[model samples]
Target: MSEYIKVAVDAMGGDYAPQEPVKGVVEALREKPELYVYLVGQEDVLKKELDKYTYPEERLEVVHASEIIETGEPPVHAIQKKKDSSLVKALRMVRSKEASAFVSCGSTGAVLVGGQVLVGKSKGVERAPLAPLIPTATGVSLLIDCGANVDARSSHLVQFARMGSIYMEYVMGVKNPKVGLVNIGAEEEKGNALVKETYPLLKECKDINFIGNVEARDIPKGVCDVVVCEAFVGNVILKLYEGVGATLISKVKAGMMSTLRSKIGALLVKPALKETLKSFDASEYGGAPLLGLKGLVVKAHGSSKANEIKNSLIQCITFSKEDICGKIQENMKQDNKGDN
Candidate 1:
């Protein structure tokens, strides 16, 4: 293990790439003294962006890559053909143990593909789930399989629940985290074949604290710590969560400014409102981790800014320090042994 938690960041991946990604790296390096970063992108463009900030030069290195993978390109083909692309290069760094983790605001499809193909999965990990922490009324909950494994089986969902439990307990500091199967009702038999099949398996699973069903509407109220589902439903929940949160914030701002009286009230509540809104911002929680991978791979929003990038990088530190991959591997080993 290196003294620093080294991360290979895709500097040219996001919409604000080179600029936001570079700025975010600088911010993370400054904030985390024990962080080392390799910014992978076109050398000249990354250098130009780096010139704008004064960061710890010793901790930051620029690794040049020649190709760029556009969002429209097919993910598997892009990763296969664009050998020198920033995203692929960073993933290879993680595969080679040159970095402890890989962080990118790049194409999600490309990241997901490169992660499984390059970094690979831990032993006994059926599938890697994209788990992101989402804000709830009480605090935050982990949504597993948010964008990976859409046609996942019941067994895949069971693994997602277990992996999500480990993440929330170790990374998020939630003890004995409650696991909930995402469903349409609280009844055990009230879901599609997948949910119904997985529920019994989770309930019988002794390692995690399975808490039964978690309705979509009940998710925001923090009904469970780990919300488990296949990618399709989980993705819909995530997208709707973001959309509703943003719309509510916008509506509040508009209403506040609509009348002179409301404007005066808004002035008095702006500070509190701002803090409340910030807590609910998805970016504030960092990028989603593709859990169950041999090495860590975090995917930030495509339109992520410097702040989101910074938070994502910081999260990698905790993830590496906790040896999340090792822990997940050990858990899977235990599960396999139990079956035999």
Candidate 2:
């Protein structure tokens, strides 16, 4: 018998809703026959979407949910009001240990709230932070605290670094991933109170690689494999990195079409550029994992399509198969022991 990983997916979450997320779950089953998914959402709509895809009947199951959480509402309020919602139902599965992991492309606040309130946090986890991945010239780097907990403390940044290092070393296959604290300058004296304080603390910590500060300009250059910061700085770096990348690509395409000569030049460079830029497509990477929670809760991009959802579901398989949770527990143990 093939081993199966039970993953509960919130079908009604995200801007794409039923069609895209459903399509993603189906695609994952197709790729990995051993993945058993229990989709939580309105039965009628989820079934309607599933009828379109040709998947193994035994592999897919539906766990009915009647409500959906919106992006605007307070997370705690939404969780309380919408008990029957897909997001809540999925978290319940994690709490009950019915599913190995949970994946959601829903409200960022709601996911964070659900993670802490329902799924709970690890033994020493101060707060559960959203860690989305970004591809660098060296490879992919884990950008910790991308979404939740905006007002974070220096100790939180240190924990993010510790947890991030463990994740990159095990899941990402990065050898000695250099950890860098996001800052205004590489100098130790530069930055606001948070970065300035974090710099020395990180430097003193012997557990992480602790390569000092990484400026915003060096992000695309892939100077560091692990970028650690509080949610405020981390979120800004993520959004700005994406914005600059998108704007540059848009300008390039426009410039290429502006003249006949440029248009002819485009054909020769299109393939190379596509290959080079392929890693930059954030959608291809799927969702960000909300680490430090007892159970894994992923927040897929709001603009996630079927393929992105598919990747997120695929990620769950790896999440369980590789025993990421157990490894994290061990890392936390070592982190608490000492700097090294």
Candidate 3:
């Protein structure tokens, strides 16, 4: 028997709802035999989808949740009012220790609100930031505060750097990951008030491997392993990254089929090109994790498909095995003690 890693999934969340999420859970369970998924959603719909899959019945279970939190609803209001929502119930499972992690491809606002309100934060953690791993030329880099905490404070960025470092070192197996404050230029005195103020803090802090300012252009080159910034900047970087990647991929495909000669060339290079492009796909990296939380909560894209969901679920296994939350708490405790 394989070691069990219970992960609660929001089967009713995301653009495709029960179909994609349910398919994802089955694919994840099929790939990872040790994973036992709690598919939280309306049982009838989820059952219909799950019926299509051939897997060990004991590994996949559906926990009924009646309410569905819409994408447009206020996050706070949705999280509060919809106690029986698929999002809320899945989060509750994490809070209650029934599951090791919660994965949702739901409303970003609800996921952020629910992660903090439901899962709670680790002690000594003032604010938790959403950190997502982005593909880079060297490998992958963690972008902190990607879509969470838009008006984050300098202290928050510092914590993001520290938490990001811990995560990269332990979970991602990057030794002493270099931390960089996203800036307009490579200079120390550049950027807005937030970056200027956060720069020195990251520089002076002994917790992380601060590598000074990292311009946006250098991010894709993997100039730093952890890119720290407020959500406004981080979100822009994330969106732009996605937009550029998508456009490039689309253009490449279009160009490949433009002419008979190119089409023949495309056939010759298709396999190699496909493998190279697959590495850059954001879905392959899993979801954005809201760090500093008591229980692991990963928020996937609203339009996440089975591949992204499967990767997210699989990543949770590594997170649990590495005791990421425990390491964050321990590091935060040490930082707090030093401050006192």
Name the top TM-score candidate.
Answer: 1
Give the Cα RMSD of candidate 3: 1.9
Off by over 4 Å in 2: 334-336
TM-score of each model, paired residue for residue: 0.96, 0.94, 0.94
Q: Please give, for residues 1-340, the per-residue lDDT of candidate 1 as tens digits.
A: 2699999999989898889999999999999999999999999999988898899999999999999988778999999999999999999999999998999999999999999999999999999999988999989999999875588998888888889988999899999999999999999989898888888888878888998998899999999999999999989999999998889888989999999999999999999988988888888888999999999999999999999999999989999999999999999888834331
Question: Candidate 2, residues 46-81: lDDT per residue as tens digits?
Answer: 998998989987988999999999888899899989
Residue pairs with clashing backbones, model 2: 207-339
Task: Name the runs in model 1 displaced over 4 angstroms.
Answer: 336-340
The order of the candidates by lDDT, greatest first, is 1, 3, 2
lDDT (0-100) at residue 179 of candidate 2? 94
The reply for model 3, stretches above 4 Å from the true place, is: 1-3, 336-340
Better of 1 and 2 by lDDT: 1
Global Cα lDDT for candidate 2: 0.86
What C-alpha lDDT does candidate 1 achieve relative to the native structure? Answer: 0.92
